[model samples]
Structure formats: structure tokens, C-alpha cells
Target: MTVFDDLVGQAQATAVLSRAAAAGAEAVAGGRGAGMTHAWLFTGPPGSGREEAARAFAAALLCPDGGCGHCDQCHQVMIGSHPDLEAVRPQGLSYSVKQTRELILRAAGAPTQGRWRVILFEDADRATESAANALLKAIEEPPPRTVWLLCSPSPDDLMITIRSRCRVVTLATPSTEAVAHVLATRDSVPHDMARFAARASQGHISRARRLALDEGVRRRREAVLAIPPSLTGVGECVSAAERLVKTAEEEAGVATAALNETETSELRKIYGEGSSGKGLNRGLVRGGAGALKELEDRQKSRATRIKRDSLDEALLELVAYYRDVLAMQFGASVELANDDHRFELDRLAQSSTPEETLRRIDTIMRCRERLEANVNPQIAVEAMMLGLRRP
Candidate 1:
């Protein structure tokens, strides 16, 4: 139950952070912080636990007993309530330069409750270029007690100047068997279901948990998998494309609805919009209009990000299914990601050549690239599905 225990398949990273934590403790005792870097860049593929590892590192650095899991210090860090820690996770599409400047100013302060002031920044890759430049200054001239833990999918995702100044911590993807074991033990999922989720997710821990626990998620995924076999005609392929886009939009709305409401409610309270016991200043509401407008704009941007993520996931699932088909056509011995759909997979594999399967996968990848380049989701998916049409 140590802080690092939750990070599966990251022994190398855990050891590095552990020694650094010891060094952090030594530094706090009026000695040099040997083996400790002022900044760390945590890089991993999606669901490889970049944020989790960084948080554990922060906990170890701040905890007096070296990350004793049950201590108050560790518990506070888990819930992001530690006085000396600042957790920054951007909900919008990008972290703006204005926000970066404000954050840098705040991070310049000394530690409040621990030996180090820890800034755990998730999705550091989403910062705009201007925002990254602003961040580079702080990292270049960091405060003595400040520690920056930045998370991204890859080292190349950030500016060279920013990444070179930080120690890199790379996490490997958890194996399917390892992910299944965690789901069965920690989430209490049945063994068979856990294995299926792990295999389907291709080692994405959070996605495996959701697939195991949520029927709605499984249904949505099944629909995406069904697309390849059902693309019999041009009209049907177009229809499937529309359905996928609609599904992504609905999923994003469902995911963000509660969060959106909560944020709006909190902002209203800050502006004194509700609970009027009479004689409240009418100017209060008027003055808060701009703030409310800004909140609305940010929420829209967040929804766009969520929708894009949903669509991208659907696209990846499609790719996995075709990959299985290609593997079967070539008689590869690897396990199929969509083994449960063996009947459909078999039929598709027998009907198509390996080259055709490859072309479809390439098309899906191109669609993903189009989406990343800000092309319309509907157009990109439609083009992909049309390319995948059997006849």
C-alpha cells in the first residue's frame, strides 16, 4: 500500500522517484538535494499512468516518512488538498498564455507546509506555444523550493528547451495480463470479464476498468466493432459514419454534463448569483457577466475536446478490429483483440485480402490525422467508412 504500489508495471520509474524522494528529504534537512532534479518530465502513452506516477513522486517528496501510504501527508496529496502542492489539469482544449503567466507567478512562492512546493501539471502537452514559452522562463529560473512535475504522452510533445531542462521519466504500457490482474483484484471484476476488458483496451488501465464496469461503454464499443462487417454498400457506410459521429457527440455530452453543471453552480455562487436574502447589490450580477461569459466559452472548448477524444477512441477501436482481421489473414499467432466477435471477424477475413485489410487500417489512421488537423469529424469519418466499404 505504498504510494508507488498503485503504479503497475513501472518498477524503473518507481525506483528513480524513490531515491529522489530520499534526496528531497535530505535537502529539506539543510543538505544538498543529491539525485533530485528541480523539474521532471513524465512521458508515457495514453493510460500509461503519467499523472499517477507524478503524483506518487510528489507524495514521496512531501511525506515526512517517505511516502507512508496511510499518513495524513499522503492522503492529502491523493485528494489534491496538500497546502504545498498545486494540481493543474486543464479542462479546455488548450492552456492559454494568460493562465500560464498566472500559474508561474503563483508557483514562485515558497513551500507552505512541506519542504518543497510541488506543481503537478497534467496534460502539459496541451499548452499553447506562447504558454509553453511562458513556462520555459519559470523552469529556467526556478525557485529553490519549487518542483515541477509535468506529464505528457511523449518527450517530443513539448519544446526542446522545456524538456531538456527536466529529468525524463518514461513509463511503459502495462501488459494485458498485468492490467487484467489489477482489474480483478482492485476493481473486484470477475476474472473472465477483466481479461476481456484488458485485451480489448490493449493495456489501457482506466479504459479496461470502464469496459468491465459499464455496460453502456461496452455497447458503444460493440457498435464500433460492428461497423467493419456491416459496411456492405456506399449508403450503409455513410449511415455508419453518421451514427459514429452522433454517438461520440452524445457520449461527450453525457460525460461533461455533471461537470458543466457543477462548474456553473460554483461560479454563480462566487458572483453572488443565488441565495439572495434581499438587499443584495444588483451590480454584483452585472459585474459578474463577463466572468460567466468566459466560463461559457471555456466549457464549450472543453466539450469540443471531449467529443474529439470520444471520436478518436471509436476510430482506434475500429483499427483494432481490422488489425485482428489482418493478423488472421496472415495466420499470425497473436491473440485477436476482437476474439469475441470471431464469427464476424472470420467472415471478413475470408472475404478480403490482407492488402485490403491493410489499406482499411491506413485509411482509419489517415482519418485520425485529419481529425488532429482540425478537419470536420463527420467528413473524416465518412471518408474512412467509404474507403472501408467492401464493394
Candidate 2:
């Protein structure tokens, strides 16, 4: 199948990209746009497949057969192995100046394929000011036959100067039905299960897919959604807060440990044995120390991001729980994401008024804001739990 097949529920976006590719092809044929300046900005919500769209566009631009799915160029662009397509995804919280400089240098060179040279800056919002400025210069006056694609959540998330230099392509979140249909058709999942996952994910495709495929992800979601009904007292509220923190810690540990092992192995390869703790090799020792410090810094950033991401997911599940309670209170026949816990939701609906559920949702939203403001995740979640426990 075509690379565009991976993008779910973005028909409008697909159309826009397809038109651009067709225009680029026409330009090449007329010799007026023989060497097209390939620069684009793809903006959309999380899990909206912004990067997937970019990859498809890149494949279409490079494929002489007009993105014929079986072509070598299309396959390489889709898998990120194309000789002329460079994708820069930040490893940590933000792209560094060093990385930006490297990318700029790479962009300055001519393409080996004698076609368009494409550079995709994924999550461009994560670039530091210096990195952004460095990239801005390249975009302002890119080399011939060079194209730059920047992906972010929104245009406002990027510097206006950089945003102005590229063409903007916006993607909307797909409807639940659309997402469910894609999962059923593409992933071969059962229809009911796909619909449940799609509704629970709130239009996030990757999360919906994970919820459909992974038992652990579904279990974690069920646990999070079950918390509101269990909060009968201070003890229970505290217990819920503790459980959330432990889960965040466990998930963060998994991410950091794997990252740490890779960094340690790379460092060891760079510095031979007997390089630690002595006057044996001063340069190697200093280099090793610096590398380890950099790794630790990145690991800390990753841990923070993982914790925030986990809490965000938990918040979404909590919102769904309250929504189900609201639906029950209104005597609505709409399906619930947590249908398996209908008994608990019924109890919640009976004990808490509709206003109470709305307020609880507000509290969760505030906690999300607090976490985004760099507050400690544990404190934010605890405060939310206590608020949710209120009468």
C-alpha cells in the first residue's frame, strides 16, 4: 500500500499533499520548476499523523512514477532510508545548536540523486531559540533543489519568522468513526474493540492503536478510569495519587534505562577499557565523563517528558470516566469507553450530581495545566486527587 495509507482520517490533508505533489510534477515537466524549492510546515494535534503525511509527500516528490507504491524511492522515503531525505527527530527535550548546525551544513550540499533534497524537522517546536535561528537561516535561502519540511502542533508553536518562510499545511483530528474504521480495516481488529479504543483515545490514532493491541495499555487505562469511583475518603485519594506516581515512575524508568544502556555502550566503545579511575588516560576519562553527563541530562529530560505524557493519558481517561457519569446522569444511550466498569460508573452517577462530574473534569484540566507549567507531576496529581475527593 502507499505511504499515505498509514495516515488515518486525514482525507483533507491527503488531498492537499497530493495536489502539491501533482503541482511539483507539472512544474518539473515544464522545466520552469525543474528544481523545486521543497519547504513545508505540517501542523496538527498529537497523533494526528503530521509526520506520516510529510513522509508521503516526500515519497511522492521523489518518485518519478508519481508515488507508485512499489517503487524503490517510495519505499526508502517511507522507511527513512532514502539517500536524499533527511529526518531530524530530537532525541531529548529540544534540538541543540550543534544538531541544527549539522543539519544546515547537510542542506547546503547538492543532492546525490540529482533530484530534490528533502530535510524534515519533526517536532520543530522542540527547537531551542538558537537552533531555530540556525534553521531559519537555511530556510530563508536554501540551496537549489533543497526542500525543508517542519512539523509541529501549530504554527504559533514555532517562531513566526520560520513559519512565514514555509507553506503551511494543517491537519484536523479525525472523527471516532473514521479512526475506528481504519483500525478495523488496516489492523484487522474486531469492530467493537476498534470502536471502543477509538472513542477512548479521543481522536489520537497511535493511542487508539496501542489500546487495541496492547493488553497492558488497556489495563492501565481501566485502572485510571476506575479511580474516581474508588475515591470515597482521604485514604483512598492518597492511594490513588500514589498509584499514579508509581505508574509514572515505572514507565519513566523503562524509557530511561534503555536510553542509558545505549549511551553507556556507545561511550565504552569510544573509550577502551582501563580508562576509568586513574591517571591512565586523561583525554579518554574526560571524554567519558562528558559523554556520561550528557547522557544523564538527556535521560532526565526524557524522564520528565515520559512522566508528563503518562499523566496526560491518565487525565484523558479520567475525563472519559466523568463523561460516562454525565451520560448516565442524563439518561443518554451513548456508549461508554469504560463499558466494562458500568456498575462503578452507575454508582458514581448516583452519588455525584452532573455538576460534580463537570467540576471534577475541570480539576483534571487544571492539573494538566499545572504539569505543563513545570510543577512536580506528583504534587499536581495529588492536588487533583484531593480536589476530586471533595464533596
Candidate 3:
């Protein structure tokens, strides 16, 4: 197996990356080839494996045998433990200029052991304008031995200057068959469930795996699917909105609770609170308050982001349900993403006009935009539900 093995259905990308890895190996051996570049930009839609491709490329660059998948360098890159590799994943709304500058400074150093120093920045599109500017200088005149790997949804999401400075590696959405096969082989998921989840995910590999493995995810999606057929009027719409918001909050809470606690504990330890002494020294504790407060602020921002992500997932599910309805209404022979909800889709299609179904889809998309724009989730989703109600 090679480093590119896990990048499902990306044959072109895999071939390019393998060639590059061979070049890198040759460069290490005092020869030259086409694979080595100062920077690489990986662009793909969500769950299309952009970040995975970046990580694999980094591993390949660090591996002497050109990314032997079972080697120590490859394993370390997979788990993000390699000394020559720095993987950045933005946790909150946007990466800060300070963080960008720090990483740039660190990128100036030579590789400790490997032939190249690799910085893998995931969600590079989430960088604030200032952060992006800070990153620009590093890519423009990168250190001779350092490589930058930036992952974004699309090159258009980044500034033109930055995109122009990097070699582009585009990943396509995997086929349902590819995703289902991975779920069954890698995760040991049952064939039927894997196929269903793969279809429902619409080519999102991670979501397909989650849907196959997590009963909670399946239940949550079912709840969202139940909404369309139950929208009686304004009252029911409001109730449904409340239910969606509550469910999103609960899911986000479950995701962040342990992370928040671990961070808090680490802070307390650093401030001497958890030691064997007389608790935290009052003076040290007082001085550390500002740091703790900043951390909490970041955590709060993260929690908000988590809630928005959860709500967006639900909205996507709702969108699929309506799309299935539209397909049935038009007598389209295309397969349904939510075939398990065929009864509801058929009922809704028969009861509503195609125009009405399209309008509801528009409303759901608008709600998603509003949430991204920081509108109150309840208000945006409630308005959407009310729009979805039959006259």
C-alpha cells in the first residue's frame, strides 16, 4: 500500500502525488525530478478528502522509501506525531494573525531529520484576512527546505496571490460505491447499512461512516426527515424549530464537554491548582486569570461553531428530503438519497406542487446562510419551517 491508498476514488490525484513522492526521494538522493514544490494547495468539497490528501503528501515527502504506508514516518504523519510535520487545524471561527505569524516563524526552521519540513494547514480558508496576509509572505519566499500544504474547499476561497503561489491538487467527491466499500471494509459496517449510509451522505465519506456506525446520527437524521411531513401550520412550525435548535445544542454540548473540561484541567495544573501544595497559590492564580479567561472565550466561540455545524447537518438532511420529494413529483428515475423515507416523499410530492417543494428547499438554504451570518438559530430555522408549512 502507498500513502495515497486511503484517498478513495482520486486516481488522478494519487498518481500525481506518487510521482511527486518519487521526485522527493530522488532529490534526497542528490538528484532532481518534478515532485518537489515549495507549496501545495489542496482543494475539494467537504468530505472529499482534501485534508487527508495533504497529510498523505506530507507523509510521502518525509518517507525515504517514497511513502511506504507501513513505515514509521508514514505512521507518525498519520497520527500527527512526526517532528518534521506541523499540522494546523483551526478550532474556532477563524485562525488569528498571531497564530499565523507564529507558524511562519516556525516554518523557517530546517527539518530535524527528514529531507523537508512540512506544514499541513487544514481549513486554510478559515484564516482571517490578516492571518492570510501573514501566511502570504511565508509562501512567497518559503524556506528552502520547508514545504507548505494548505487545504481549502476551493482555490477561490483563498486570496489569488496565495493560490497562485502553490501547486493545486484537486480532489473529487467520491462515488457512493467507493464510500460504501470503504465503510464496509475499513469500519466493518454491514453491507446494507453501508450502502444506505453512503447514498444518504451524497458522497461525503466521513458522514457515510458516521451514519453507518452511529445510531445517534441515524436517529437525528430521521428526526429531521420527520419534519417535512408534520408541518401542519405556524404552531407546529414553531415547535419544530424549537426541537431542531434543542437537538443541535444537545449534540454540540456532547461534542465539546470533554474537550472543555480537559482544557480547564490543563490550565489549572499550569497555574499550580492541581499540585500537592496548598492548592493554587493566590498570586499565581490571580495572574493566570486573564489567560484562563481568553481560553474560555475561545471555547465559547468553539461551542457556538459546533452548534452551527450540527444545525447545518440537520438542514442538509432536510434539503435531501425535499430533493427526494421534488424528484418524485417530476417522476425522475434517479435514485433517491433518502429511499427509506419514500412514503413521506411520495405523500409530500402528491400533496404539494413542485414549485412549493422548490420554495421549501430555497427556504432551507436561506436558513443555512442566515446561521452562517450569525443570526439567532431559532429565528432563522423557525422562519424556514413556517415557509415550509402548507397553505
Off by over 4 Å in 3: 275-286
Candidate 3 vs. true structure, TM-score? 0.95
Model 1, global lDDT: 0.91
Instruction: Give candidate 2's error at residue 230 in angstroms.
Output: 1.6
**Predicted structure 2: lDDT:** 0.83
Compute each candidate's TM-score over C-alphas.
Answer: 0.95, 0.89, 0.95
Error of 3 at 50 (Å): 1.3
Q: For model 2, how does the per-residue alpha-carbon lDDT over 1-391 read when each residue is reduced to its tens digit?
A: 6667667788787777777777777765666653234678999988788888888888888888667778899989888999999988876667888889998998888878766788988988989999999888888889977889899999998999999888898988877898899899889989999998888887789999999999999899878977886888888888899899899889888878877888777766666545554542664566867766877787788777787778788888888888988999999999786777789999889988999889988999999899888887778888999999983
Best by lDDT: 1
Clashing pairs in 1: none
**Per-residue lDDT tens digits of candidate 1, residues 180-237?**
9999999999999999999999888999999999999999998998888788888998
Model 1 scores a TM of: 0.95
Residue 214 CA error for candidate 2 (Å)?
1.1
Q: Which regions of candidate 1 are displaced past 4 Å? A: 275-286
Candidate 3, residues 82-103: lDDT per residue as tens digits?
Answer: 9999999888878899999999
Q: CA lDDT, every prediction?
A: 0.91, 0.83, 0.90
